[model samples]
Target chain A: MKNLVLASTSTLHGQEYLEYLLPLIKSHFRDCSKILFIPYARPGGISHEDYTATAGKAFEKAGLQVHGIHEFDSPHEAVKQADGFFTGGGNTFLLVQQLYRNDLLPALKEAINKGVAYLGTSAGTNIAGLSMKTTNDMPIVYPPSFNTLGIVPFNINPHYLDPDPASTHKGETRETRIREFHSHNPQPVVGLREGSWLEVKGKNIKLKGDLTARIFEAGKEAFEVEPETLLNDLN
Target chain B: MKNLVLASTSTLHGQEYLEYLLPLIKSHFRDCSKILFIPYARPGGISHEDYTATAGKAFEKAGLQVHGIHEFDSPHEAVKQADGFFTGGGNTFLLVQQLYRNDLLPALKEAINKGVAYLGTSAGTNIAGLSMKTTNDMPIVYPPSFNTLGIVPFNINPHYLDPDPASTHKGETRETRIREFHSHNPQPVVGLREGSWLEVKGKNIKLKGDLTARIFEAGKEAFEVEPETLLNDLN
Candidate 1:
């Protein structure tokens, strides 16, 4: 069975993101020898060996062998040797840049299509969508916004949170910002709040989070759906 | 001369944006009869008629004839009857939605290529770029992110203001948000802060605003440049 789990970030991962995957990781990959980790998304100016190590420790605690792809000469070789792939997120743009520059997106896409279990977080989730246009980050810099791996139809806005009241910054609120996005957009967007994730098993896309993900279509009010809602179920 | 003007939409007219365009509008169309206004971008829940009125009044104060394209049956006809076209701001997604649904982008692009002066502000400026991926608004909805008029190679993030400390509502600060975007992005992005505009005259893309605009390329620090800086001059 082809399985995919996407989270907001490796840093943000905890009971919320892991609860849904821990059982599966143990049950499915119990006899599976190794897991490949892609740590090439270092451009968010925050990627460190310690960060990747921490994430590896999580899987190690779950009884899986984790190997960083950076240790291998080629991503293809790494993928070929692994039972599954775990992609922890940092910045979607940085992740995609590394993926594209090294020509790994197509290879990863091929791996998924070939039935590899794929796990990703924030930036990883953004890459799973049709385009990076829906990311919550500002246009600080531009990567190939049009060069997503095309894993899903709609874009994912991960680490989604409501505007905090204690902070000071003048601009639209998160909801308003999203409303602004919907106001002009002609396509539907999935706003996955923090602690929420989307899991793909076979052809079923299930929402896994505490809050209902917001959906916005052109010329309509943004609406929310319960967790585990299937993408095929959305209009 | 294929002239293009981008305005700042703070007060909607007469002040920052129109002050710069009035003299140019008068000088460029001295022998021409009238200027056309395209006001279909009312998606931000803002007033489109009022926004257009601001431009019309500004042009009238300059002793130039201004007519809204809503008065015409089709944008093509509006283009044929006028010497130039001015697109006022609101929600760019809405404008692009109307343009795409009405199939007006190609028509506008054709008109600009045919030597008609094209002017845009905020959302209007967004359409002139290669894509709206850099816009500061929420991705509330999806228009055709691929259907921009392609007048410029990079995307425009308009109404682009720095984070203000005076208000209280917490998310990422605008600068942080933009930095986050840069962290992920692998391409160059033009961050056009409020009161800033870009002037495209023939092949020259000049920045015009009170403060320097911010530019970001992959894996580099964001740099700022003064007004009228040529696009090619960016390195």
Candidate 2:
């Protein structure tokens, strides 16, 4: 029974984001005193030590010890030594690529199943899904499509936005992109706009975001859901 | 071999677009007595008659006979009688939906194999590929993913453009979107800007446009090619 807190970065440091995440981390690891930071995703070309240092500072400011995974030779050792792991957001594609290149997806899945608190943001949020097809970023790089950790059944489209009228360039809107993804895919996708997240506490999965998050199941109308709605079975 | 000219419009009857397509059609089909308009794709939701009229009028002004496929109940027969066929621009997702629903893809493939001469614009251009995954439109509707006529090995991303600087909105750019597509896709995709076209003549596949086209192949740098370089491939 572990609590996972996935968050979009407010800034690079734990100091900036730790306030938002500290309570949740403390609630899960009442006896533990430290949080581990995973920075292997930086090699995917998005995150760097300068970026990760900010994340470390956020946790340190929260009065929690933080360790970078880069210190370990393998993700398994990092996970084993930590009470809970926090995966910060950078580029999900790049993150997954690094995990895949190092053959860590299986180990991460095992850790999650064994009750390692799993937290992610942005691109990290994408890897929680069955596939990364729903991601809104450009696939400027290639990663193993099947390498997702599968903590969540539906795909996560992070940084989702409503259409803006000020823009005149004519093309498909973000909602249209998600709809198109659903049209081609048989799986459900959760379009999580910024400031929104999905929280899993034991067997309970709660939608923690704005007024409503968009949910699209294959061949069905995409509907909005409040925080109280049942989304665990959405996939 | 039959000469094919896929146009962005069918009739250009009353629109200003005729000025752009009329001369091209006349010059390309100078030897042909008639041009067949495939209107079956209209049922997919885009206004068909308007598109047809646009093309029909342009041909008529050039003193060429323009016949709509509706003239015959069976498209197979229409293909047999056609000197060359012009497919107009519309929602390619909808067009392919209709093509799949009516089982017209195989029939059209047969017709093209017989050298009946096929020309498609927009949605029509999409179906001239190995698959339609590269289309820029939203598949708000579901369509069958089946074998296209195979005139090209990759999908055509029509109306492709770089992000407009004058606009203000936060999201992934078109370049990023195409890059995301290539990240997950193993096949190559050709991003064809508006007013640009791919002409397949015999063993030749040439790109015709005012600007460079972006070509994305999985695991390679997305490169740009001038019209001249692409034209060389036509032979």
Across residues B108-227, which tens digit of lDDT does each residue of candidate 2 receive? 777676676677776677778766666655333445553466666676676677766764333446666656555446667777766667766665667775768888776678788888
lDDT of 1 by residue, B1-235 (tens): 5678765443322345466667766776666676788887653465656656777778886687778777777766777767788787665656776788777777788878777887787778888877665665543334554348877767666766666666332234555555565554444667787667788877788888677888876667778888878985443
Tens-digit lDDT track of model 2 for A1-235:
6366554333222234545556655565555554577775442243456556866776665566667776677666776667667776654556676788777777777777777777777767777888766665433344544347777777777766677776443345666666656545677888776666788776666788454788877778878888666577887
Q: For candidate 2, what is the DockQ-based docking class?
A: incorrect
TM-score of each: 0.61, 0.59
Clashes of each: 23, 26
Q: Which stretches of candidate 2 lie over 4 Å from their true place?
A: A7-44, A47-54, A57-71, A90-94, A141-144, A164-170, B1-170, B175-235
Lowest summed lDDT across 10 adjacent residues in model 1 chain B is found at B8-17
Model 1 chain A, poorest ten-residue lDDT window? A9-18
The per-prediction i-RMS, to one decimal, reads: 6.1, 7.4
> Ten residues in a row with the worst lDDT in model 2 chain A?
A7-16
Candidate 1 residues A1-235, lDDT tens each? 5578776544432343355557656765576676787876543455546556766777776788778887788877777767788776655555666677777777788777677878887767777777775666543333444457666666677766666676333234556655665544444667787667788877788888677887766677777889968885543
